[model samples]
Target: MPPTPIRASLLLAALLLTSPAWSADPVHKEKVELTAEAPTHSVKGKIKGYGTAEYTLTGKAGQTLRVQLKTNQPSNYFNLRQAGKDEALFIGSSGGNSYQAKLPADGEYTVQVYLMRNAARRNAAASYSLDIGLRN
Candidate 1:
């Protein structure tokens, strides 16, 4: 017996229908570090500038994400939020130089850090450092 063209087509169709789709969903994990310097002091020995740092992370659907932030100064503030969201999921201030948070679902996210005080307020100086990471 010989296989017909129609039969071959049917067999191919069945195999494709039963096979699992292999979409390339890559898992990504990485870390970023940033540093910013405060503006120089004025004639009266008053510092007058602030610094900021930001990081962006991407993930697959249902993947878990972890983020960590660190600063050299004590008065720095850290925040995490979805890429386009206006509100932050986590925030910390006046704590140890290190902070961490986890993402609820897959997508893009951002981490932001800024100085806690204005230099003019009390002639204080502000600087920031940050570290960020993501995992499946």
Candidate 2:
């Protein structure tokens, strides 16, 4: 027997509803590196502006992520964010630049660098580099 219009529609709808057309958030476990240059020094040899660097990270819903950073100069700082919340992950002065943190959840996150405006007297420029890594 031929199916009625309503019956055919119902069958099609049921088939589509039961089909697998959904996916969960992807788990990303990787490392990202970033770098920035310091602003030019003032005539009196004072650092004027702060340089910045940024990175985005993604991971599973409940996976732990680690971030590491290293710099060449002093008075440098870093900030980490996950799920839109920001935190000052690291701050250093006159030493090697390195920092680490754990991921909040399975989503996109960002890390930023800020060069402290009071590093030295002469306005000089310097190159800065950052290294980031992740783990399960």
Candidate 3:
């Protein structure tokens, strides 16, 4: 049976409401910029509730990458992932707030800062400083 226009609209709305990504918080993305003479950059920002901040930086394989996060909220943490990938190379909640590693591939990497579910549910806000560095 062919569905009516109203029925199709209702179905679409339902699908959208039930989609896994629908409830996910919108991400704030920014490209990490560094001065030509400095290998490090510092960014300070604030986030509330389920908000997320993603910092993307490009690097070459074998280059060293360093990231340090300081936040007021204890539950706030960060994750490091390669571009277009869901799995994290480093999960700050489990690994602590500092991450230093040699790049495995030549591409963009994202450092995502977010609050844990418990804190986010309480509408927690965090002010954070993220220091990122890339060097040989």
Best by lDDT: 3
Indicate the TM-score of model 1. Answer: 0.48
Error (Å) of candidate 2 at residue 120 is 9.3
Better of 2 and 3 by lDDT: 3
Model 1 poorest ten-residue lDDT run: 38-47
> Candidate 2 versus the native: TM-score?
0.48
Worst ten in a row by lDDT for model 2: 38-47
- Would you estimate the TM-scores of all the predictions? 0.48, 0.48, 0.80
Per-residue CA lDDT of candidate 1, range 38-106, in tens?
111111111123434455556554544444444444565656667667777677664444444445666
lDDT of 3 by residue, 28-93 (tens): 899986544888989999988999999998988999999999999999999999977778999999
lDDT of all predictions, in order shown?
0.49, 0.48, 0.91
**lDDT at 94, model 3:** 97
lDDT of 3: 0.91
C-alpha positional error of residue 46 in candidate 2 after TM-score superposition, expressed in Å: 17
When sorted by TM-score, best at the front, the candidate numbers are 3, 1, 2
lDDT head-to-head 1 vs 3, winner: 3
- Residue 92 deviation, candidate 2, in Å? 6.0
Candidate 2 regions with alpha-carbon error over 4 angstroms: 1-48, 86-97, 120-124
